[model samples]
Each structure stands twice: as structure tokens, then as C-alpha cells.
Target: MLYQDALLERLESGLRKSLPQWGLPQDAKVSLLEISENATYLAEDGNGEKTIFRVHRPDYHTEEEIRSELAWVAALREDGVVETPRTIPTEDGSPLSSFSDGEATRYIAAFSFMSGKEPDAEDDLVKWYGELGEINARLHTHAREWQKPEGFTRKTWNFDTIIGDGALWGEWSAAPGLTEEGHAILEKTAALLRKQTDAFGAGEDRFGLIHCDMRPANLLVDGDRLGVIDFDDCGFSWYAYDFAAAVSFLEHEPYLPDLMAAWVEGYRKQAPLSDEIAAALPMFVMLRRMQLTAWIASHGETETAKSMGVPYTEGSVALGETYLAENG
Candidate 1:
């Protein structure tokens, strides 16, 4: 625990140092917003002007990869494709900035504060999900047509990077509280996912750059605007994977079928959905579930991971069985 505490101290110090790069005053009231893969902070000056600061966890994405992400965000905003927080550039006019954490250099970026709450389950989730679907479809449409900048690079969420040896979040087999029985079930499920996804070939129309983490938690719903956030996971993946990501961590909800149908309806409003792609939605959902299971294991230090704990592992096992029975 001492090491973790020390790490936190360093991060706190780094965040203070980073504010000056964005011209934030030393007296800026900074409060933590969340701690997942990155540490997000809400900083307000004496005048009540607020900015959202994102302190990136090192080694996750290279400086170049981050620039690539910001590039896309700029394009998305400039093209009016979606409503999202605008990037607040540094004093030097760079979209990204960095500070020393004593141990390593951590990157940070500021954004114009977006106002909205995450859509709650009790709310009209089915309706919001329809809007979410339309937003994703529009993003996909832009991704397909936009000309990417030279040397642009972002990781791909393919079979290899998702659950295979190259799994980005970590191996599902290493998940906490995984029982031997559960492991066996997931192994079979993974094998099936591999077989089916291998056949789902990545054609230009079916696969391209996408916002890989479009879950409800990443959304901000005001009266009429659905603002998306946390594009940190945006990259190349199957178009259907975005739908799978849309339902992250809520895989077992009874209203899932209704949500999926709503999403498909909303997506069709913007672009065509082939019968083949439509049929493969469940497979992508299973893949995302397994990926998140691994994420909870590897990111156990985060509150979100701790809250999920063993129940999520067990839930994945049940979902795996259902997926296999239906898809087998």
C-alpha cells in the first residue's frame, strides 16, 4: 500500500505541475472526477470557469497515438458529426501536454467542460440508446470517409488484441475469482468466438476506425444533446463492435434485447446494416464482455474494477454458456 500511496502522491504533484502548461492558476481548485485507465480532474479557477483535465496513465498510448486521437476529435468537431467536449490547447498551442511524475512522464490534456449526466438505468435507457446508436453510426460514417493524417496510428481491436495472446486489457484467464469450472466454460466460449470472428472478415464496409468505448458511461445527456466523451479507446475494429461496446458491463440486463433493437433501428437511420453483420452482433457482444472481464482483473486497483469483483466473472460465465448454446 505504501507504493500505491507514493504513486498517488506523485500523480498529485504531476497534476499541479501540468496546470501551468494550460495556463491554469496555481490556486485552481482541482478535484478528481474518476479513476479508471486515466485520472480525470475538474479544475475551476477563482472566476468559476471550469475545465476537465485528463491525466493519462503512462505506457497505454504513445505520444503519437494520442496526437492521432486528438486529430480525429478535431475532425469530428470541425465536421459537426457529434457533440463532444472541445480540446483545450496548451499555452504553446499544442493539443497535448506532459509533466514528470518523478518516476515517468505522464501526458495530460484539458477540455472545455461539458455539462450533462451519465444516462441512468432508471431513465429512458432504451430511448437514449437509440440516440447513442445514431451517434455511433454518424461517427462510423465520418470514419469511413475522412482522410486520416499521415503517420496516424492507433491500435486495432481484432481477435488477437482482444482475447488472444495480444489481449490489450490482460488475459481473461487471469481474472480474479475465476473458478476452474468457469475457466473451462470461458475457454470454450473463446474458441467459438475465434472461429466465428475469423469468418466475419474485415471488409472496408464492415470494419474501419471506430469509437471502441461508446458505453452509456461515456455519454452525457442534456435536454436534447447527447454528448460523447472518452475517445481514448477509439480505434480500428468491426463496426458491430461499437454496438457491443455500447452495452458494456450491462450484458445481463433483461431490457438488453429492446436496447439492441433500438440501437439497430437508430443505426439504420444513418447507414445500411447488412443481414450478415446484423447476425454477428451477439458474437461481438460476447467478445466485449470477455474483454471487460479481463479489464476488471487487470485494473483491480480502480474502484470500478473492485466493485465489479467476482460477480462479474461469474456473470461472464453464465453469459458465455448462453452465447455458446445460442451460437453453437
Candidate 2:
């Protein structure tokens, strides 16, 4: 469902009308920021206060799931575990507000803006990954120990949910510029990952809820402190997968080994990860690539999809082939 210009304009207009419900003044300005799984807007009030307004794509996330995500984020803030965008409630005291133009129903939520810069891929990635490692550790530690509210639920990033025929992000075969050879190699790579994962097994220490999307895009470099935003994809999965996600689109970077090592070193400072689990890091990387391949295939209109285009899929294939040659 690519949002045509007219559709986006309509949504922005609707958002402006709904602003007052969230305490924004009538003169608040709403502008599109980014579009991925959702259409995000940067809403600024007359006094220059800013907030992020996310209009979720229809049929992707249930109301219950959205509530559950907010609950975990709220808990993280209250516990001082990490700095997440504070979710704002509507006038009715509800976390989510709904809007529909009689065609598609959109769920909207607002959050106080967290300001920071994103780490550049050309920069010292090892240093950035080290900071990310510490951030990932803190989130995982909180996920393991924190008690969930009643009926709390979220998506799962297991093999079945990610690479299976009914994968949430669509099939990798459809990713643009994916060759037959590429698809074949990726299929083999997927099989290998499944086998390794079964062998590694998921013990309580190794699996739990995680911030599944840890790419640089989700990170905000706020001074010396790093702030993580976007819990839309938070779910249960292997703890080591977080490392794979940290290096998500940069798998082909030559300094990948150093980055992974830095992440491991940073993580070990907070909690213990056995060598056996560590050995499966490549499998997680391969898994994350597969998931991204599917995401790109399904989300053709997104800026991420447009920028990466065919080159990203081609790179994934090359990476998959190399991984298989080394480990198969």
C-alpha cells in the first residue's frame, strides 16, 4: 500500500485536525518525516515544541499489540533502563487515537521528540557498535527481568515467523534484482540457519523479548548517551540476534568482524553469553539479512526500499554465498 501524494496529504490534514486532542495548538504544523511500516510526521506546535506523530499502516498491528508495545516502553522509562520517546496520551486518556477517511483505518500515536544524530556508516563503526552493544545489553537485561503486564503480547522473530512461507515481511524471492542464483543460495542459507538454530536451541538465558530492529536508523546519539527509539518491531527472539541487527545493512562492510567483536566485548561487561551462543552469531546475521530481504521486497515504496533498491538484494546474495562457502 504505497501512500500516494493525495493519500498522504489527506492523512496529514486529518492529523492536524486530531492535534488538539493531544494538546497541540491549532496552529501546529505537521510535516512528513519518513515512511516505512508507518507514515511518520514531525509535528511542531506554534511555540516550537516538537513531537513525532506516527500513523500506522492499516491491518499490520492490532490495537492490543500497540498497547503492549507502549506498556513496555513506559516501563523502561519508569525503570530508568533506557531513554525512549515518551508516548503521549490523547484527551480521552487513551494511548492510541484512531482516524479513517472511510477507506483505510489508521492508528495514530504521538511521542515527545528525542533529539540526536545517527551514526554514519563511514565513521568509526567499531566505536559506534561498542556503544550499541552496551545499549543492547541494557535492553536485554531489562527484558529478561521485567514483569509483563497482564495479557501483554508481541510478535516473534523465530525462523517460522521470519523466513517461512508466510513470513511477516513477505518472501525474499520478490526482492528487486534478486537473481535465481541469489535466491538459491539464500534458500540454502536459510536452511543452514534453521539447522544451526535447532542445534543451538533456545534456553531461557538465550531467548526473550528484544528490540528486533537495532539498525543505526533506530539509534539516536544524544551526547555521550545513546537513545533508542521505535519499539514497533519489539518481540521475542534470540538474544544474539540483536548483534546481527546492529550490523544489519552493513554486513558487507570489511570491518564487520571488528564491529561484532566490539559488540561482544561490550555485552559481556553486563551479562554472560556462552561461547556456544556466540558461535551462532553468523547464523543470526544471515537470518537478519533474510528478514531484510523480505522487508525490501514487500515495502517497495519506502525510502529505505528506494535507496537500497536492487543493490541491497544483490549484496545480500553475495553475502549469503560467502557465508555458505565458509560455514557450509
Candidate 3:
């Protein structure tokens, strides 16, 4: 409820006192530029230096887990697989910092900013499918080093758990955009979930530290190369789920399968995906779509979110209907 600014003041003061390991002067002029529920940013300094200040929700991730994540990112950079913001350390060189909030909450640390161009949003946009694959290959290959944190459950990212939380399915299924085809999608997926409950949770799905939310928005394409950012959602998940998420939001972009294949081939080169994971992708894709729409429907308040989402929400519902009809 303090909004992003109040959180930033506390985060900046901490950064000023901490994070010399990031190679910044103690008194470096820092400015807050980007702030989200899980991240805060300091604008470009006169020397063009910038760093992302972050605070992961403690309800979901622990402080120690966050520290391990940064350490892993630093290690990945050393491996030359992918690019991540360099983690800056506190004066004592610890990566974790805290503002001493209630036991359930804590303010975390910061990292140097990585770079990328904004993805083209226009209709002519060529979704960088193959490049996305290569990037994911590097990400998965690099993520294998970090030990998973405790109580960090693995998410299979299928049709059930994503929107099958019971609380959501009823309303989500009844949302305004349910095309007749969409109804079939829900019905068929429900049946599949019931038939394959145990199969959905397979451990052979190549679980490791996944980028978790590999959306187009979080990736930067410099020339033919791709750089990733925004690790707020990084965690233990099925590798294909990460790949599914990368291509999920890009349905509006051109050439989706091409992009997906590029990422899949690259990831497979590092660690081959099981047939079960490959077969489960469509359901997971639909599940992710439903879950994201439901997230916006429930939490979206800003004009931009609601306004931009109105069309997306409707489009997704429509897509659901179409998938349902085709599968029927």
C-alpha cells in the first residue's frame, strides 16, 4: 500500500549504503526510473550507469532464496551463456538486505541493469522465435548451477493448476469471452487434467532453475543476440513451461512456431525435453493464457492495464473458444 515510491526511498537508501560490489561509487547519483511490485529502478546516471532495485514478495520467495538467485545469475554471466544484471553487494558484501518489515515481508537487494530493445508491438512484428530458443538454451544451461531453495515447489504449468485453483475456474470459465469453441477447450482440458493428474506432475520434465516468465517483454534483442532481464519470477519449474511462457504472450506477434522451435531446439541442445513435456505444451499454453487473463481481470486497476487488457482479455477468450471448437 506504500506504492512503488515509498518502497524505492527505502531501497535507494539501502543501495547507497550497500552494493559497492556492483562497482558503483558510494555516493553515485541514483535516480528511480522503473518500479513494479517486484522491482524498482535507478535511472541512468550522468555516466550512463543504471541499476535495477528489486524486492521479491516474501509471501512467495524468501530472502535467502533471492540471494541464491542473484549468485546464480552472476555465475551464469561468468559462464557466458546469457546476460544478467551484475549483482551489487552491500558494504559487508552480502547480497541480501532488509528493511525489517513484519515477519512475512522484507525489502531485498539490487543489480546492475542489463540492456535490450523494446519488442515491436505492431502487427508486422516478427516474433524472434529462433533467437528466443537460443536465449532460453543459454538461460537453462546457466541456471543448472544454483541449488533450489527450500519450500520452493515445482510448478508443472499445465491447464489444471494454473486456473484450476477451484476459486477461479468457475468464474473464469464463465467470463464474457467464452466462445462456443472456448467452452469445448475448457471441457476437454478438464477431462485431460482428470485423466492425467499424476502425469502432469512428472519430475522427468527437466526441472531446474527456470527463467519462469520468459515473455517478450522481459527479453532484449541487440542485433541478432538476445539478453534477458527481470528475474522476479525465476524459480524451479519445468523447462518447457519456461519455453511455453516465452512464446505464450507473442501469439499476436508474427511466426509463433518458428520462435518456439528456435527456443526449443536451443534448449534441447543443452537438455533435451521429454516427450511428455512436448506433448503437454498446448495444454500449458492454454493454461498460461487463461491464468494471465484471469490475473488481469482480478488485479488490473490502471487505465493502461484495463484498457490494453480489454482487447487481450477478449482475444484470449476468443482464442480459447476457437481452440475448444477445433479440438472438439
Candidate 4:
């Protein structure tokens, strides 16, 4: 834990240095909020006003890609397609700033503090998931109709980028505690996914820009508003992939069927759902499971990854076996 502690201290220092760029008090009380793919902090000024500052992990996204993400967030808010946190510009009116943490230069962006807490399992999950489905449908519709700015670019989450040789998170084959039996099962599952997704094809309606990480942790519930946050992973992918992402890390839960049904019902209210795409939802979920397995292996330093550990790999194997039996 020494390494993580040291890293946090460095990042905290960087955040303090960055606050001035956004015209915030240098002595603002800043606390770490989360440390996933990025280090997020909550900064409170002397007047009690708050802002969220996100320090990007090095090498994950270029400056251009970060700007593209903010651009989309701006459009989504401006067009009333979704309720997202507004970006706070720097003193010079730039949406992003940078700080050197000695090892590498990290980009930092500030956002208006959004009010709400993440929805928990004890809540009315069915209702919340239904709302999530509708929200995703609206995002998909916007992705389809909106005109992207020139030079807009983001990563693509196809089979190759998700799990194959080009896997972004890392290869699932390297997952902790993955036995030979489990590896074989995942191999078959991957083959089946390739065949099915290839046959399904990437038509515009089926595939487009997506919020690739819409799990509940990124959702905030305040009264009737369901605010979505964390666009760090947004990119090009199958539209149905959003549902798969929504159920991340809970693929084995019993209520999943009910949740999936609610999501489909809610999504249908906003857009058409082809039988082919609907049938492929399970495939996408399995694919997401595998992708997350890879993520756990590569990001073991984070608490979330460490907590999941070998159990998550074993669960992926079990899920893969069931997927192969049902779909292979």
C-alpha cells in the first residue's frame, strides 16, 4: 500500500497546483473521491461551494480525445438530451489544464459538483434500471442524429479492442486464478461471440458512439433526477453494449433477468429494438464480463480490482460456461 499512498500524495499535490488554473483557492479543502481509471477529487472553497477535479491517468487518453469527450458532454447538456455535470473552464477559458507529477504530465479538468448519491442495491433497482434504459436510449438517439465536430475522435470498443489481441484492459487469459478449464470455456465463449456479432453486423442503428461505462457507480440519484457522470470511457461501440455495461460486475445476480426485462421495456419506449439486437444482449453481457475480467487483471492496484481478485475470474469462467452452453 505504500506505493498507492505515495501516488495519492503526488496526485493530491498535483490537484492543489491545478486548482489555481481553474481560478479556485489554492488552499481549498481537497479530498480524494475515487481512484479508478483516474483520480477524482472533491474541492470545497471557503464559501462552501464545491467542484470536482479529475486528474487523468497517464497515457489512457490524449489531449484531443479528452477534448472530444468534453465536447460531447457539452452537446448532450445543451441539446437537453441528458443531464450531465457542466464543465468548468480554466482562467483562460480552456476546458482543460495540465500538471506535472514528476513522472508524467496529467491532464486535469474541473466540473460543477453534481448533487446526488449512487443508487444502491437496496433501492428499487427495477425502477432505477428502467430509467437507466430510457436514459441510454436517449443517448443512443443523440449519438445517431448529432453531427460530430471536425477532428472528433475516440477509441473503439469492438471485439478486438475489448478482448482479442488488441484488448485495451489486457487479455483475460492472464486473469488471476484462471484455471485451464476456465480458460477453455472463455475461449469457446469468445469464438461464439465473434460468430454472432459478425453475423449481427454493425449497422448504424446497432452500432455507434456509446457511454461504455454506465454502471450504477457512475449514476447519481437526487430526488427525481438520475444524473450520469464519468464519461471517461465513452467511445464507439455497439448500442446494446450500454445495457451490458449497466450490469457490470453483477452478471451473476438472480435479479438480472428482471433488470434486463425492465431495461428492454424502458429502452423500447425511446427507440425501436430489433429482435436480432435484443437477442444479442446476452452476448454483449458475456463480452463485458470478459472485458472486466481483463480489467481486473491489469488494474490490480485499485481497490475495486483487488476486491474482485480471483473470485471475479472464477465467476467469469462460470458465466462463460453457461453462455457457451446456451449460445454455442
What TM-score does each of the candidates earn? Answer: 0.97, 0.96, 0.75, 0.97
Could you tell me how far off, in angstroms, the CA of residue 263 lies in candidate 4 after the best superposition? Answer: 1.0
lDDT of 4 at 1: 25
lDDT for each residue of candidate 1 in 265-313, tens digit (9 for 90 to 100): 8999988988898888888999999999999988988888889999999
Give me the runs in candidate 1 sitting further than 4 Å from their true place.
Answer: 1-3
Candidate 3: TM-score? 0.75
Report how far off residue 58 is in candidate 2 (Å): 1.0
Off by over 4 Å in 4: 1-3
Which residue pairs come into collision in candidate 4?
A: none
- Ranked candidates, highest lDDT first: 4, 1, 2, 3
Residue runs of model 2 more than 4 Å from their true location after superposition: none
Query: Candidates' lDDT values, in order?
Result: 0.89, 0.86, 0.60, 0.90
- Model 3 lowest lDDT segment of ten: 167-176
Q: How many clashing residue pairs appear in each of the predictions shown?
A: 0, 0, 10, 0
- With a 3 Å backbone cut-off (N, CA, C), the pairs that clash in candidate 3 are 19-89, 19-90, 31-43, 129-259, 133-262, 133-263, 181-321, 182-320, 182-321, 185-324
| Model 4, span 54-169: residue lDDT tens | 99998889999999999999999999988889998998999899988787888998899999988878988889999998999999999989999998999999999999889988
Candidate of highest lDDT: 4
